[model samples]
Target: MRSQDENGRANHEAGMAGGEEMEMVEVSSEMRRRHQRPRKEEAEETEEAMSVEQVFEGKRVPGWREQLTFRAFAVSFVLAVMFSIIVMKLNLTTGIIPSLNVSAGLLGYFFVKMWTSVLDKAGLLKQPFTRQENTVIQTCVVAAYGIAFSGGFGSYLFGMSETIARQTTELNDAQNVKNPKLGWMIGFLFVVSFLGLFALVPLRKIMIIDYKLIYPSGTATAHLINGFHTPQGAKLAKKQVKTLGKFFVFSFLWGFFQWFYTAGDNCGFVSFPTLGLKAYENRFYFDFSPTYVGVGMICPYIVNISVLLGGILSWGVMWPLINNQKGKWYPADLPSGSLHGLQGYRVFISIAMILGDGLYNFLKVLLRTISSFVSVVQKRGATSTLPVLDDGSPITTSPAVSFDEERRTELFLKDQIPKQVALGGYVVIAAISIITLPHIFSQLKWYYILVAYIIAPVLAFCNAYGSGLTDWSLASTYGKLAIFTIGAWAGADHGGVLVGLAACGVMMSIVSTASDLMQDFKTGYMTLASPRSMFVSQVIGTSMGCVIAPCVFWLFYKAFKDIGISGSEYPAPYAIVYRNMAILGVDGVSSLPKNCLTLCYIFFAAAILINLLRDLAPKKIAKFIPLPMAMAIPFYIGSYFAIDMCLGSLILFVWELINKAKADAFGPAVASGLICGDGIWTLPQSVLALAKVKPPICMKFLSRNMNDKVDTFITSLS
Candidate 1:
């Protein structure tokens, strides 16, 4: 069978011509036991081959195992649902439930992973499933997670009905306002969530296939699947499984310790610390939580840079400038002058910066997409006049070579980019954009919507093709651009918009991680197992997650609040904007945040200019100038990643150098071990948490032991 290229184009004319003459290599019985039947020609080529037919003919189908079954899904689901109910009760008592606030979508992902693993072990589903199956599984998982984590339809309705009541209570004592009813809120959330999913589906083909977005998690999953295909792969997989089991145990305990020991106070194990620093008072603070760590690990260098830049602009540049102007030398009680206070200025600055960046980026992407579209159209037109060639027949009246004819003859031929697919994609984008317009307008006024819709596309185009940042999910740079426009129109108090944009960015990162995980597994399946079976596994996993996620969110929210933190404890930058709008008339927006805005704009502009000039400069000079990401990231966080990346690169370089010097081959095993070790180490925490056991202290103590083992192993091999 021929493999398709990224764009589905077939390039192997030789493979096509020599298809029947190819010999099949003998595959182990283990391999045969896992896969379906081979084609007739393949079976004939290897007489001793355990055909796909023999493997399934008399074998009993698998089902969920008793011990390691879909219990995770059920447990997650029940917990999530129960938590939502608990959130309602907690909301009544505490006013806000901090831990209850989490992404329902993420909860779904975990549920799906566990559920799919169960289904895979059981013979209910075929191995290597199709894309459709994957979709189904994902949907189910989301649903499951949602059921567990969501605050329920009734809760949203209650929130809506009590909005007036809550407002009234706020007027008397703002802190005493209870949580809003869940009915309408939940309804709206579900609606938007569904829309987001719908919007993503059409974009998948372009993003995943055409754009080839590398979902790191997906890649890991693919590696895992590949490992299941052969003896070597299975051995590696077994090791990973063991390592992950231990890691989860460790992580759970670590989480508990951080919650109990470090954070111990009137507020339970988790507390959002306030530094009392004027610039950060309104900002939510925490002592480096696991969620943050996980986020840091998952988010790429580029995004981290953007966030760091935003923070610096707000705290470093803007705050200092404001303090100097006031001649107060950073007063203890920094008067709340504007929306984000000093952070407001940063917001303004970010807007201006993103605008400039967006403009440059938009034109570039537009030009590329148009160019590609035109080229494809022309190719189709030209192909209409081409002569057909088949079965080695003589080409008659053919004026030019036919790429299509050549492509079709090969078994492992690349698929052509069909006109229909492209057209369909474009149509879907248009439809989604239109459908989402009202929601956008409702949330952001019409003027803001106009600016976002008009300017965002331009920025997206510029950034995507021009700067080589092809992942154009409106929530990234364009959202920053939108924030700028909103600030410009409504003033700096709307720094909350930037906060919202950041939240969206975080959500997108989560989604991207999940999607990437699926994609990686798909790649593995393509390489080793049946594609169909893998698809099924993915579907099963994703479905379970979907259903269970909501409940988890609810549980966490309640748990956090019961301990003392407010539900709104999560740094809701957007809430700041809402407060500003409510207090200061929309017309007095200028009196909002200013210092944060200025700093943001300054840094953003500087970063964009630096990157643009570097890109336009000669190759040698450009090489010396690192990507904008280096400048955009905050010095504190960026430095850590930089050092890590540098060290990793150095290790790889040294290994390659030594291997070449000694005339020895270095294999993928070393790299795989590093990657697997990192992922596996994190797994134990989850397992221990689920098991409701106190986290194991030995896991932490054994860190030195593990490192020593690794060092010894590496040195011995050397």
Candidate 2:
């Protein structure tokens, strides 16, 4: 059943890959099907579709109230906590988080299915598990943990810390560095996160129905949910649960085992130096991180390869060449992690590439969104028989609607959120944020907050439209744009760094939540779940996340003594990068090391050129092109995890060669286990650290001379 579900997801992706042409073909086919007599298979399909329609029409599907169950919320809260830990760990460590939608849905199904079965066995079952309920669980859990990602625990927010400030080259304003406080963090999130939901609420019908956007992730998740409620899927899910459970335990034990060796700095599988000392100096060894390995499994092959290529280019080639110039290029005696030396090149060059790529994609998506909106408007104008509402929703139009689409439209429109309420809610939240945010981060003036809110809707629509077309959310890009604009606007003497970072959080929350809400609407449409249920679930989840994400980050911040420190267990690499971006915005290019700006310019142009080449190149050649964004990550951090990810990719490649079906069926389950196990281990690991309990062994590797000297000293002492 998982295999079938995976195939459905694959098919949806492939169909979407055809882009606008596929959409046109699908529309034409629907129109043709309406006119033609159905063949046997087509008739069977029609029958199945009719049954689904009947379910949504109220014979089987639950109402909005029934969908939002106490049991679902209970399950969501538990899973949200667990997934929050996982997301926080990923955020702090690699700053790259794979989507956990499928895993959340799977786990939701597993837990609920187990409950229902036990109840049925005891004859105490009052209600059976429904796909709608499972969707609520998935939605709530995703939204809750999503805050962990968007909360900037590892980026803009954490970057405000004094620890991260010390790592930069610029003189950071003492007033700008804000430490993580549980009280203020929760309050900050409450002020910022919910506005985005209301920002896009009025456009739900326009985006999902009139635009007919794909929203691939939401559609795939819906398919996965629908698949799981079937009898065959239940049995399959049981096997998958066992598999996930078994590996999760193994990964947990592995983490525990690895912990013993990490009694001292650089003494463990994490820094195993797999390629010996010379390569290790260049950061080209696998650190044996299960989280990254699992991430690689879930991410596309190209992304993993791109990261490795980036690592190789930076640590392998560029850094070595730059280091040769020593005192001429940068001061020779600076700390390895100091931004005044080689670290400057690493951070700035990567930032250059990131900004370049982000700018190109932002323009691309913005233009595409504009063009598509124009096209949609033209089509709507050409066919205007039915009366429309102020929101552009048709009153009774049904032309060109397919059987399935018509069915979904009926259910989706059944509980439409009022436009007045949406607009009023947005205004209230924005007003509150504009008023309250200045108190939270005094550097960010009320006007900055107001401007971010004012322009947020336009950017939110672009992001939502782009995400619907291509499953990629550019929320972070929008945030960075805010950072630069507001930071420069505020200037250095006014604590622009903190202002920019704070504004980033506000802008990011709004746009990210907007796109996310639209995606959930897509899921709700496909699964016949009520928009009201999804919206309520999102609010509850966001509320949970406002409290939970900050608390989790606080635990890590308190427990791990060296968090956000370069070369430490949790480098939080993006913190320094984001902080530097704010610095650049305030101080301009003068803060860079000698010749760094020239290198940055070269890389920036190179990034844009590479993107153009990828788009213009033939598919056979284009697939090999490395992603600038993926590659930029390792420039500051290192290649060790890149090796780990490639190893995962290699494992997947071999498994597919051995048995494609099993790989497709159980691959995500296995990957999720590796990630969750190691991720969950962070909880106990933090607890132990907070208690000042150290591991028993220090498995350090030394140079031959150092080893000989240690041995001689030990012998003489004896």
Candidate 3:
């Protein structure tokens, strides 16, 4: 207490000393951030960081705050609608799904802060948005996003409906009918998605609480929210807000110039020559989107290096070999979308690595989960006779609260979601899943539903484990395995196979949705936001998504005349992958082209080998190893996109070399703004596209036509 007082006094004296200078120089957020320093974290804390004992014993923060509020809900709902629609549209056109949590945090904090200022002027506003409220808003954003993309919403938008139509003989024959079981699909999604929510609660305790696993993205998001919620945090956030605002505006404008002014030809990347070789043919390029660069900056340098390595390995080395050995190892005529270039080959390798890494990570978590169970069981065996009527208080209460600061600091951990309410919601979800899973897919027998019910908990366990431990839920692969199993038993041989495959998508959605929920719950736990509020927000988003997804899909479907065509706006890589999974479920991988299968095996092995190599490599080398996802992602997307992504990463990769400390501290702020700016700008352009208004067209036309002379001169010189 004395130290805190001394520190505050010192800061106040410092402020007074600078008061005259403050008049001459504007006191910006950066100035405040540079000046303010907490005497001691706890003494200066608004919401104290969790104690080490709390981490080990699974104790909560010691205080309560009302989290569910009108402001939080209202913000969540609006962003949910906007992000879902824009996300679906972007997913279709670009095949890249941007996370809206950071964007949500940014926009929510700004708006609420602005609104509070307005209200304050009117003498009505009492306070700024609380950390809990901001968390609630983020909860909504994540929920809405997961629902739109993971909950069969985005899948349906891209090509699931038509894929179902093509695969189902009965649906195909129906006049002007697509996805004949659309209603069933809607119900199936609702049930599976929500049921997984309730069903995963048990696992949440094991994974998030007891084991205390950190969902990587979720943990980072929690910290971001934390920064905005508290006074000390807010000061830090001020510095970021400045950078974020400037860069966000800059990025949005730059995106507009590239996407509209250049007719999408110059979107985010610049083609660069590698050794001046046409054989490379602009295969190499640098993308300058701040978001990508930010992404590069945020991760450890080695991860960035690994990404570059993957690009070089696949495009530079692997492509040449594949080209030379085309007729022997690869097919004579590779499918346009499948291994179209070095870029095409990247997809297979990435998928292999992602699945391989996910499964490997899952196993690691599984051991922990199992060990936890063993410990619990062993504890029961060692129980004493004196504790027959043991009190629960000892276990629930923290014993270390001796001082005033300790008590005050521990205040935020006291409240939690009510057990009865959460469990009841889960029960409702379970009942819905049992009834709807079979009803949605009519071909499935009672036993199949029973099997799915039996398997759901297990799948949820693995999914939750992977998500909690590694932040990579390999639910898609696991879902595929389950789908293949269930589809076979449900009789994939029958004409009702498409229905069965679709059920798998729903099943996967359940695992995914549940996995996502647990991850978010972990975030809530860290931020001292009520898990109940997060759950409620999630349910709301999921329910809203059920209606919103199809509507958004229908909107884009109408707006874009040629959605899935070669030059169409929406590439929908996921939808394409999902379609292939359905086909593989029905026809089996054996029926696919021999060369494609061969490549799958080779890549799968490569993926596994690379991961093992990275892990086994000495720490110095291992730290630089790129994640499988980094290597794998480039292969599936356009070379231009990959190049841009790499470019963003390269900036950080280089920035770190220049100044590691400054790069580490301010890099995230810049990177996040850049990412959000580019992503958020897409909505306006998309709306214009939907309205059929060609923005910047006249400017582009005049410039291109007027520049023909310059172009001719340049061409003649070349």
Provide C-alpha RMSD values for all models, in order. 15.6, 6.7, 11.3
lDDT of each: 0.32, 0.78, 0.52
Error of 1 at 162 (Å): 13
What is candidate 2's TM-score against the reference? 0.91
Q: Over 4 Å off in model 1, which ranges?
A: 1-181, 196-231, 263-318, 327-340, 346-364, 380-472, 475-550, 561-569, 572-589, 592-601, 617-718
Candidate 1's TM-score: 0.48
- Candidate 2 deviant stretches above 4 angstroms: 1-59, 381-400
Candidate 2's error at 21, in angstroms? 25
Q: TM-score winner between 1 and 3, please give it.
A: 3
Better of 2 and 3 by TM-score: 2
For candidate 3, write residues 543-647 as lDDT tens digits: 776766656665665555555543234555545444444444555655443365667777667766766676578755755555554455445443444555556
Query: Clashes in each model (backbone N, CA, C under 3 Å)?
Result: 126, 0, 18
What global local distance difference test value does model 1 have?
Answer: 0.32
Candidate 1: residue 557 lDDT (0-100): 39
Whole-model lDDT, model 3: 0.52
Best prediction by TM-score: 2
Question: Native-vs-model 2 lDDT?
Answer: 0.78
